[model samples]
Target chain A: MHEWALVDAVASAAETAAEQEKLKKVDAVVVVLGELQNVDRAAARRLFAELRKTKKKALHRARLEIRAEKAVFRCRACGKTFGLRDLNKLSHKESEAVHFLPEMAHVYTECPACASRDFEIARGRGIYVREIRGER
Target chain B: MTDPRVFSIGMRLSKVRRIIAVTGWKGGIGKSSIACALALALAKAGLKTGLLDADFTGASCHVILGARRSFPKEIEGLEPPLVAGVKFMSASFFSGGRAVALRGEEITQSLLEIFCVTQWRELDYLIIDLPPGISDASLDIIRLVPRAEMLVVTTPSVLAEETLRRSLKLFRAMRIPVAGTVMNMADRNGRAVGDKPLDRVPFDSGYEKTLGNPRALAASKLFKAVARLAAKLDAGMVRN
Candidate 1:
């Protein structure tokens, strides 16, 4: 699953942080999953668990905690803020396309209020490392 | 918050030997065509090559390579589909023939995501079809892929050459490596730029008909000129 790739990125970031912070053991890695990307949390967690086995000892003890963030968009034309549910429903194919590349939302969805494609993704884009707790 | 995708980009392209960012200063300079033809040429020469259509808004490498719009197989990461013996990846695969309207930041996000998720195999050459002009995609490639060598493309027109000079100045200022400049759609008496070796790709009138047909494209004179350019790049690689 593509979640495996995102989880791999999380692992890599945590490892880099550990090395930079001179961490002896990484205790927890907080990863934020944006709703727009629609990454499967269960798959990400499972993959992170499997990935830890092959990673260094510093990351082996690291706990992967994924937090969800709701998608928000703001229409640049009318300055109307909206959520994913507020917009017209996207087709299965369109949603899948957005899942692969979150920017595809611009192609598939538009401003619910003004119907302008020039809407900014105000928040909740994609996966990122929120925090990495470790024993330095 | 740290973007984890940044860390994985290096790991994703760790196996790629040479990353060539094929770019031009102006649109309609045949940058995409050169990138596609070069990728095909390299692959035909038995070098494992990959072509990433990084022009998110104006992705046409898929069309040039005659690749169908389909999702790449998910195997740990997205594996680029092999088109005409060249592994190809593009946003067109996801956009599905629709226009991808994205701002500069969105373009950067998409580019980073593509680099982070697309798992490139051990490639001798990875040719990236960058959008025309020096913009977010070009700068992002420079920052994200520091090892990338820029293969500037220009035409014989004075207007194209002026922009080419400006782009070359910027690349030089950034200390980016220039593989060489390609004078695409050159006239018979077109003079090469500066002291650089002549890498002129003559304008083939039949090039338009070869679009979306890889067989005809490979047999075209455009492909022949690009193949020669590919050979020169290969030799340079060996020397380096």
Candidate 2:
């Protein structure tokens, strides 16, 4: 749901040729995606597949690249930050596990400082276009 | 770069299904009606069909399908009802028409969740009846479903055509194939006057043609024709 803005960003950049003249021949567009956002990799590639069909000169040979960014979790009670892989050990999915703060079970995984369940999501951010390559 | 990692690690491997998003820039152009008719047609053709009413304002697919309430329980990844070979799902069944108050993003989220969490099993075609115009909700489906195709509906009126053209451009930009265009409210034999062809609409070429009052009967006939066209194309696409 939240990935549309990111999709729009990719489309907007490509439609306007934001950095076609930067440097070197371009053959692909690379995007960095966050685990927090549910970005469909196949859809992103398919969108570029359609985009390249028309702009054969530059994007014709270009492929859309997607790389995942790990999700970050934070504990509000003691300001703790941890990766989702670690949270999974505590029986929590990346997104759902973060919400289980000190409130639900204060003894489960307390804040290192005060051993509290209060927590908030931090670090693992949204999606963004990291690089664009084309014939310079 | 043909990244094998995307295919192996990142991409969600779901069944290959055709997603047909039926839309009309203007309301009351029989978008939902045509979608339902087409879904039923495909279902009868022995294709596993799923109809989704993306129109959050007026969820009428439920009424057309003769079903009520979005199925809360899934019978093994199949939440839609099995009626006459077609499976149906709609915001109407879930919200009871209360989805209108939801924000645009909320509607998109619900739409995605319906696709993600619902037990569609192995559907051959998923027909989505989108809300009016080229809004965020429409874009959400377009962006999410890489295989999503589009069908534009409009009345022959000039205003409707202009609006439908803008929508056509949107689909083109998204690279979604336009299956076909339908002109609703086409000239009918004077079915409105005296329940006979005698009350032919002025300038109507076919004076012998007589349609019925309330306009639905004539519109329904048009929908059936469009359904036949869709069925033909769908079958061909599958074969090829």
Candidate 3:
């Protein structure tokens, strides 16, 4: 999803949560995000801070939480689930061989068994509200 | 009324040379990449360059520069960290793995606070990677740095072109000179492939690549040409 669309989703989710909780104002918001989405966490927090302030509900103090998501990559041929951090260096080294991928999108790694540039990201593709706090 | 605080802050920021803004109305147009390329180019040309990633939702310069670990700190003022002799400040640095979505006066104040207290000791260039659209952050920086130059990034798509036209109006209003427009992701290499036109650069659209891939090698080469343009403009602020 585009960056702004994600922000809108988060804000809409927060409003829905607030309504469901029967709260007049939200005190804090917690976002759970996957690392692969290409979104900046810091910008989201600052934008949310300003967004909360200008709302009609009069939320005096509202904060946002950013939770990073780590993923596990499973080799399609070898059936090995390697932690992303362990495979990243090797993946970066092998990227030189496959120069056709766009600058923004990349092939993460090469399969050890098949030796093909194929791997599945088992985790790290969800962004949602993990928690929210309202005026008590 | 001209806010006295704004003036004080503007006075301080005026010290930095080559204030180039990377802006576009439509998103996903490689705004940050252009800023990174420009900043790196300025640095390579022996200038002290500072990069500011102003986009709250998609601050990618840190990732592109491979400096995702170092965060910006405030030692009396907001001091951006250095990478390859180029100083950079990004909303990503402040994000502790969260999002920063802001607009209007708050956005202006945050940018101003960064400009006011930065330990930017006599730099030659400051490249600002502005967010999408005509928000307060874009307005504030343009207003604050009236002499700064702008480089509008746009794709050949009609939506991006329309947006760029509107943004050009904003720059005109602020009296900021437009250095040029970058046609990012212009795939075909176009008519003057050998001559290398500044308006067009080819980019692969396939999804087979991963992070840190060097698909932009030609684009990186174009940075040298951009530096030539900067030098020709007499915007070379580097003392060395």
Candidate 4:
């Protein structure tokens, strides 16, 4: 149910593009889902599928494909970048905690170079529909 | 996201064998009457049946079912009141005749809460009367209950063909089985409605009148049509 918002966001974005292109028969909608978003995959797919019925002209024959973008973190103190793999380089408990607190990773682990607890998410924090395929 | 308790509670409840949503391509296509009639006819067949009035904003299933009043009770969870020999749930029970002043996330969450808390009795068939067109409520039901099948309802008007086709094609793309399409208010003498002609609803004033007066609904053409559709639904269930 919480994921309905995300599903609506994806559908709304696709409809916006479809309206701009004036495409009548969208073949598919491609969405980039951020891992940090932790959306329910099946629920999102069903929502997108149901939306296809209402947005008929905009998304005719539309299918949803959610490609998950992995989370990447950048150290604000040292300006270095890393991914979830780096988070796993910590103690087993700390690594597991990353799943729940990915945004606050700087609190548990220090920057490898500057040893500072200040960092910002550089990538994989965005969930957006990257492309929509119309009758082609 | 729903609370973990909601998921567990919903899982604990028994599963209905089949969930069919009767949806219209557009409003004023008699979606609710067909749904209510189908449910009644199915119930007449001695099957355990339930009808969910899912049109939160414009709920009228209770009216069609002639459920004059309901007693809200809580056992382990909310139990749907019985109406006309069928287990029934409707948003009208909660909001009365007044409009539900809800929008966006509130509507979606209300539906989710209903699905989570309502403890339905075991049913062989659970028919859902959906709001016209695809919407947040419809999508919530689709996403929440993956086993649901959709039945598209449309009139034989030339204006409705394109819209109906779009709906059917959408179910195809989404991998949802459309049992068949119901052409409402088709001419009694028409040869056929579509390729297979699952059922046809003739524009009968008696049937329309019966909607407000339940006792007036006595084996009319509409009744037989819905009964025939129920038989077809059984065949569809078996095929699946």
Candidate 5:
């Protein structure tokens, strides 16, 4: 599953942070999923749980926390600010494409006000590792 | 907050032995053609190879290789489909041949997503067809794939040669290893741009018709020239 790859990244990042901080055991990790990417939280949590067991000892017992951020786009040509819900509905194929590579949003979507493709993903564009807490 | 994708890129590429980025500073200089042909040549020589069309907005390797428009399978991650015995991945599969307009930051994000999610398992040579110029894709490739060696391509025109020299200087300043240069579409009597040794590929008038036909492309004069260059690269691998 694609989520497995993403979850693996989260685990890998947490492990690296734990090692750098000289943590003996990682207690929790917080991950944020941007709305534009639309990652499945349940799948990410499950995969992270499964992946932690195979990682280093510091990450073996790490708990995974998931969060979502609303997607916002600002047009460069017309100075229009909008959300994904304000744009035209995407086809199943287009949505799937954006799910894999969120940058595909620019290919399929345009600014609702001016119909311009030039826009900035002002917020909520990708998956990120928010925080990692551990015991030294 | 940190992007976790950056941390896993090295792990994803751990099994790949060599990464050769085919690049040129100018467009229409045959970077894609050379990259695709080089991949085919390496595969023909019985080496495990993968070709990644990193020119997200202007992806043409899929067209050159005649690869079908099929989504890569998701097994642990997206696995590049095998096309003509070479593992192939491109943004064309996602865009469905539509034009993708992206800013520099968006390009970097998409590139990171690709490097983080795609799995190229145990490849002997992974050829990256880069976009033209020292833009986001080229700069990010240098930042992301530290082990990648540049295979510069240029035409016989003085304009192309001037840009090639500038690119070479930039690469040297960055301390990037240039595997070699290829003088593509050169005249029979044309000399190498500089004192450095370079492989020359004479212009093949019939090369255009061979596009989208892997068999014909493999049998073309262009392919034969690239195959000779591939042999040199393979030999250099042994020396290294």
Candidate 6:
């Protein structure tokens, strides 16, 4: 369900990029999905393949590559940034909460060293289309 | 020149140049009302403006603008319907007065759907009415549109200030440009916390009764302040 939207948004963005670059065909689209959001690479690829077969044949020759990014957060108090791998130090309850409910991430997350509740999500919060490689 | 980095991975970029989100830390503080007024004010000022009700659960922009459910034409994709001088879209148009029961993936998908499919004309500003609280929907909006500026709404109560602080911190910590604060439902003692008051919208029964009328918005004090703020934003005179 979520992959369709991601694929649609990515495909549309590629269209605008394609038009601007005067490209006749798109070669490959690389999508880097954030761990924080709910999206699967297989689902995204399946959707992309289906979309290419539709009326938007401009993407017929294009290949889809989906990559995952590790979720990261930056502490506001100490200004230290850490990734999900650091969560091994967290209590099981806190880690589970973050893994299940992404919106409640702030509630579970705190600076490991300083125990600061204040932190800005430095990365892994947004889905990015890293590159749209096409042939002119 | 359009930067490739600015676009979301697969998002079809619309012509809407500037996107502004009106939000509050808590609910029932008139976030939707001010968002509507600001968009209407900009439209009234001869600028092409569009308003999207991102409050998927509580879609009331249609009611505020006195607009009925309209099926917007899909030129190449979905579009926000033009209503009451502001090109607007709300969940009510899709749900048909029924409650929308959407979970995590559904919510994110719906938002992404709107972003990818919506066809927008060239516009000066696009105002979004965000749901109260730091929900997943709101965070995605911030992440989805990285260039978007934020406008916070709050009442003058101490409780409101306490909650507003968290929101202010989130924006500040994330390095998002906060346009300014509008003290909605403020009295004489009502003050915007942390941030300077860009405008004060007092609780008025007169304004309440005329909410759905576009003609009445033209003379509203709220509209004047938002319009002035819009002018400042357009001129790049951001508040410190």
Query: How far off is residue B143 in model 6, in Å?
Result: 1.2
Error of 5 at A84 (Å): 1.1
Tens-digit lDDT track for model 5 on B1-240? 989999999999999999999999889989999999999999999999999999998999989988856569999989999988899999898998889888899889989999999999899999999999989999999999988999999998888888888988888889998888999998876567665577888799999999988899999999999999999998894221
**What tens-digit string does per-residue lDDT give for candidate 5 at A11-89?**
9999899999999999999988899999998888889889999889999988998888999999999999999999999
Interface RMSD, in order shown: 0.6, 14.0, 17.9, 16.3, 0.6, 10.4
- For all candidates, state DockQ relative to the true structure: 0.91, 0.03, 0.02, 0.02, 0.91, 0.05
- A80-108, model 2: which lDDT tens digit per residue? 67754554244443233112111112223
DockQ score of the complex predicted as candidate 6 = 0.05
Instruction: Name the candidate that leads on lDDT.
Output: 5
lDDT over C-alpha atoms for residue A2 of model 3: 24
What does candidate 1's lDDT look like per residue over B1-240, in tens digits? Answer: 999899889899999999999999899999999999999999999999999999999888888888975558888889998999998999998987888889999999999999989989699999999998888999999999998999999998888888888887888888999998999999986776666555889999999999999899999999999999999999894221
lDDT of 5 at A54: 83
Poorly placed runs, candidate 6 (over 4 Å): A1-136, B1-11, B195-198
Position B136, candidate 1: lDDT: 98
lDDT of 6 at B232: 71
Tens digit per residue, CA lDDT, model 6, B133-240: 888678888888877788888888887788778878888899987887778877899765664554677776577766777778657766666677677767767554
- lDDT per residue for candidate 4 within B169-238, as digits (tens), equals 7777888767778888877543443454546778776776676554456467787877888988887742
Off by over 4 Å in 4: A1-136, B5-13, B188-196, B237-240
Interface RMSD of 6: 10.4
Clashing pairs in 1: none
Q: What is the alpha-carbon lDDT for the whole of candidate 3?
A: 0.59
Question: Native-contact recovery for every candidate?
Answer: 0.90, 0.00, 0.00, 0.00, 0.89, 0.05
The true-versus-predicted C-alpha distance at residue B104 of model 5, in Å, is 0.8
Measured against the true chain A, the candidates' chain A TM-scores are: 0.96, 0.58, 0.65, 0.74, 0.97, 0.77
Please state the CAPRI-style docking class of candidate 4.
incorrect
Q: Give candidate 4's fnat, 2 decimals.
A: 0.00
